[model samples]
Target chain A: MIKALEDDLSQTFNIHFKNHDLLDEAFTQASYVNEHPHQGLKFYERIEFLGDAVLQIVVSEYLFKRYPEMPQGKLTRLRAAMVCEASFSDFAKECRFDRYIRLGKGEEKSGARQRPSLLCDIFESFIGALYLDQGRDAVERFVRIVIFPKLDEGRFDHIIDHKSELQELLQKNGDVEIDYELISEEGPENDLTFTVSVIADNQKLATGTGHSKKVAEQNAANMALQKMRGK
Target chain B: MIKALEDDLSQTFNIHFKNHDLLDEAFTQASYVNEHPHQGLKFYERIEFLGDAVLQIVVSEYLFKRYPEMPQGKLTRLRAAMVCEASFSDFAKECRFDRYIRLGKGEEKSGARQRPSLLCDIFESFIGALYLDQGRDAVERFVRIVIFPKLDEGRFDHIIDHKSELQELLQKNGDVEIDYELISEEGPENDLTFTVSVIADNQKLATGTGHSKKVAEQNAANMALQKMRGK
Candidate 1:
């Protein structure tokens, strides 16, 4: 499993870790360490701590250089939106990190591998391990390849909490009626999906789908905002 | 004034900026920009923003690597203590940054350069300017020379809120009577200085002096705690 995951990571990232143990530790959870005490594997917490700092600096530098005219307050908000849990989880899902996470029997039984927070931590841990094995340039390259493209493509727009933003934008021209309507619902009750459409001034602006109504509404609002901004 | 300040900074940091404008911007407050509208000098806010992130990653990486066995929580607390406003202000004062800050006449009259918040911002701004003028290696070296030695000497001991820390330490060995007494007061009412003594179980442990009673008490507690730890 480790070898297969390593190959996948290498193929995906176009980079390989010299110290395979760092890569191994990136996927190993604390619960897994408890069950495999003799294996001498470290958990992901420390690596996640380091990775969190690395991510902050890399993203902050990128934003600072990219937006020369942007105010500090906006840069801070943009950085927060970019590196929040949802964005990290999305990146993890795109990389198929859930397939590589090592969990104890109990944790595996509880489906902890599919958890968003766990995925986020593993993503950060992977960055940390990559940083230690390679260097800042490699880690920055990885971020550039995996994360910056997504930023350019507007993949993480939903993290911006755009409903309030859209309302605020519309409110500039006096009071305007903004609404999100459930357009469709599907799948089982436990895993139901929702599609919502955002309307402003009786015009259907945009539509989006998500696992929950609120998320769908937010996505729809975000799409509407992006279109409004002509992005 | 700018040329003299630049020479002073060059001597202080032992590194010269290729672009002297970055150094000028670092010390240029918003009020200064307001007064010198035709000078095309930018304020320190944006630079401070970048420097803040740079400082965080540098300090965090140092702590993470230095204390391999330290927990993430403790690392976070230590980083906060190291980079807090008070610590940055102290660093600024040590470099005599207040002597070089450019402020409008109103701010100068109000002693804005001596303000802790302003000092902290200027310190971070100086780092940002340094990072831009040089590179990461130069910025890291600057931090090593100027800041890391202080960590070794425990200059930021007061950042831990030593009064509470001392109380917690004493409380661990059952209840202990910890008292702070005003040992002496000097200067006039408007510019008075206070001397405080920390007494534990009727034994005077340490004494400290500050401009305010609260600061004097905290300094006294910090000194006592340091004595207890033999640091």
Candidate 2:
């Protein structure tokens, strides 16, 4: 089972593990270790710990360079949104990690492989194993290929509610007044499109149109955030 | 004031900052920014954020390589002990970071410079600045010169209570009975030393002596931990 999964991972990811044991250990659940006492199989907890640190640094470095002008708070928030458990689970699903997980009979019956937290842990453990077997370059390459495309797809954009993010960003500058005003309404009431404008310090920052007033306000806030971020 | 501190830091640390502003920002408090609004000075929060991730990765990498046999949980605990507020404050004081810190009149009057939290923030921010001005290698070098030596000095050893650490370690490997037995007492009652032996699974692992029974037990646990850690 371990060899088959290792082969699948290599074929699917286009990366070969020098130490197959590391790869196997990355997928091995704690429950599996509990059942196989004499097998001396190690769980993925340690690798997960290391991989978490690696992921943090890699993402931080990427954000630090990509957004040179972004404040540290915003950069930190962005990194958090990108690497949070939900995001990791999504990445794991995309990589078909569920298919390769090694669990005990109990955990298998309980459907532990489909768990988001477990999947996230496995994802991080895999990165840890890859780092150990290959190197930083290989780990970075893996992240870039498997994860960076999500950035382009704006998968994490929804994680940060633009309205709240904009508000927080504005608050950091001082007690600045921020107002989203309804500018116009188009079409009939049932299918109306609302235009909203975001004003920071009485200056019109940006405007957007949406199907509803709330969405229009959010879109306006998103536009304002982009403007403030100098994007 | 900033220039003088910058010179002192450069001289003491043997590090030349190409972008001196980054270094200055690392020590600039938010209160200082409030006082010098027209000066457009940046605070250390953002740099501290980046520096924090850098520090974690550097320390994690160091430990991962240094103790190949150490379990991940222990490694995590060791990293936490090393990077905790107390440790960072100690590092900051050793570098005389208080002298370089830019504080508002209010904070200065209140003796905020000597505060541990502020010192830790500055220490992390300094790393951030160093990473930005130079690179990972330079940041790692700084940590190695200033922080790694402390590990050799046994400065962080006391941070983890040996008894609890040992219990946690033993619990990870399944259920095991740990017993601490008082072996002997020496000297008069008022100034007596107690010797204790730690037994795991009825096997005496190590013995320790201390002035009090609790201390003796702790010392015995520490000895047991060392033996188990293969030190």
Candidate 3:
């Protein structure tokens, strides 16, 4: 069973772990170890701790070089979004890495096999195991193949998180209260178009229309960001 | 002047950088770059971001292997202390790496050179430079010589209950990883004797037998303390 797992994993990862024990440890969940303590198997959490850091550096270096003129604050925010649980979990599923996790009967019954957090940890632990077995170059090669393409496609830029960007810009010098209010709503209950206007320090900025209030506010924020970028 | 800086750094760190630009960037403070924008010379902030993550992963893996049985929370706390601003800044000054920092005229007037935060950032940036130029093995060797000695000297922050004193002693000035595990349980249900062992930095320090689990842990900690006093 484990041999088949290794075969499939190597095909997907484009590399084989020299130390198979580390690879097994990376996929083993704590719940599994708890259920089978006598097996003397380790779990992924500690390796996940290390891999989280590895991902951090790899992403940081990539961003630092990719956007050379970008400021440190912006780089930090982009890196956070790129390495976030949502991002890695999505990448894990995309790579079919989710098929290999070894959960205990309890966790399996609880339907934890598909949990985002678990998937994220597995992704990180796999990186850790790869780093230990194959070194950083191999890890970089894996990421360049698996993650950088998605990154280059701007898939992670919803990270642009416009509302927060607006808040950060407005609050750059001092604390300023920003509010968004639904200025208008039209059409039927099932298909209403809401308009939202953003106001900062009692000064109105921009208004935008969307299918929902949240979407309308985001659009409004986007308009304000465009203004900031231009004016 | 930059060449002299590199020579001095190579002497202290015992590794020469192949990419002098990165080495310069590592030591180049942001204030200095702002004063000389056309120099096309970058500052430490971006690389510092990478270095900070490198430091985190290196320290994390070190703790993970050193205290194989320690829990994640304690490992995290210990890593934080080791990599915190207070800790690295002292290391930077100890290596006299602070002497090489090039400050802007304004920053020099304000005496920013001796700032602990600045020194901390330099320490991290230097690590970043080393990792990029010489690779992880060289970075690990650098840490083994420069940082690990100070760590072994018991000099950072401090922490004990029976668990905590065994912890405090093992931890000394800084926090260390400690774990307690049940080794044995024997005899009839009502007359069962529980044996617990205390582990400090992944080594079994002592074990004790008692009627109750808590009593066994307390006795185990006490015995560990006695052994420490003797040795």
Candidate 4:
């Protein structure tokens, strides 16, 4: 078995897997193990479980420090988005983990190589292997290079933006026009309350009141999103 | 501010908090912060978030190393049972965290002192504080003392036993009779299979086939559990 990582893995990420067995296991699939049972090969799922915890702690600490005043509930939602299958698969692709996936012939033909869940699992197992090889600091450094840049670029900012969330949800089933209409303005100028209605695909879904137009629109979108979830 | 832990914390657990703020925050309830607005007291939720991740990695690593043959799905379920509100709260109580709980007058009057969720949060925040003060090894040592002994005592074994799980689920809403019957046996002596049916509260729940009567009963209970979850 080709158990050792390529030189680029060390040169790019400063990671040296002293344990070749773990490195091999990280790239191995369960199907591959089952197919070649006599080869004494191992799968990545066990390491993925460990790597998930490593990722969880790293993300949790990063968020805790980044947003000192933020509440736990919002931090949790943001963490979920960061470690989600879509995000992890993208990270795996960026790290070229897909190129190293070891699969049984059946799995390879079935296109398991390009599957998001498989990609996510391989990435996590890679992380798990890295954690075991070099401990949490090495894993943190790896994440700093691969994941933090995205967070710094505000890729995860949409997690807190209900308006963006509403747009994304509606846009999932193809493009749809989303309109925010200013329903009303009330009270004194200094203490004015704005009411906004969110209309998606010609349907007025929800109306919300807030201190500012942006806030009101966000609230409206929030209500609309909640309604959709309730169904 | 009483921002320091008693010497017993160090004596019993060998934990010394250099950052007394994190330690103080761990023991401070959210309600206390809400009530004492001018005092600048912080709640434990943020630290609890960090602590939860710290706890997760520790537990994950522990389980991974202990059970090399266990699958990820089973490992995940076992981890959940270990860190659940009921289990964590029990750990907190055993560590005498209840004596250190800081609550507002209203919360104290409402009996928040004995609440399991509150206990769990404090335990987690305490762990988070320890991680920040020390690091993963210290946190691991803490869990080794607090959580591992219970596991070694087979306290968490119930998590993997479907029969125990089904019994607990059925027993949740008071007592209910549960029975397992050997429905059939088939095939040659060396390749024989047993079919068992599980009945709960006089209603036939599910049937499963396995190599042995015990295995078949467990499989039946597993099916019943799945059906209950689906409903």
Clashing pairs in 3: B160-B164
- Restricting to chain A, the TM-score for each candidate equals 0.68, 0.70, 0.68, 0.68
Residue pairs with backbone atoms closer than 3 Å in model 4 (clashes): none
Runs in model 4 lying further than 4 Å from the true structure: A1-5, A160-231, B1-5, B160-231
Error (Å) of candidate 2 at residue A42 is 1.9
Off by over 4 Å in 1: A155-231, B156-231
Give lDDT tens digits, candidate 3, residues B118-197.
Answer: 99999998898888888788989988887866543445324113565467567645677788899999999989999999
Global fold similarity of model 2 (TM-score): 0.74
Docking quality class, candidate 2:
medium
Q: Which digits, one per residue and each the tens of the lDDT, describe model 1 over residues A99-161?
A: 989899999999898888999999998898888899889989988987887754556454445
Model 1 CA lDDT for position A106: 96
lDDT of 3 by residue, A1-231 (tens): 456668977786657767888989989998989999788788998888878888987887887766555567778888888898998898888877778888999999988878999999999988988888887888899899878776535365465556776887788678999999889999999999999999999999999778888778877887887686663
Model 1, total clashes: 0
- By the TM-score metric, which is better: model 2 or model 3? 2
Ranking by DockQ: 4, 2, 1, 3
Q: What is model 1's C-alpha RMSD?
A: 10.8
Worst 10 residues of 2 chain A by lDDT: A152-161
DockQ of 4: 0.61
Best-fitting candidate, scored by lDDT: 4
Give the worst 10-residue stretch by lDDT in candidate 3 chain B.
B152-161
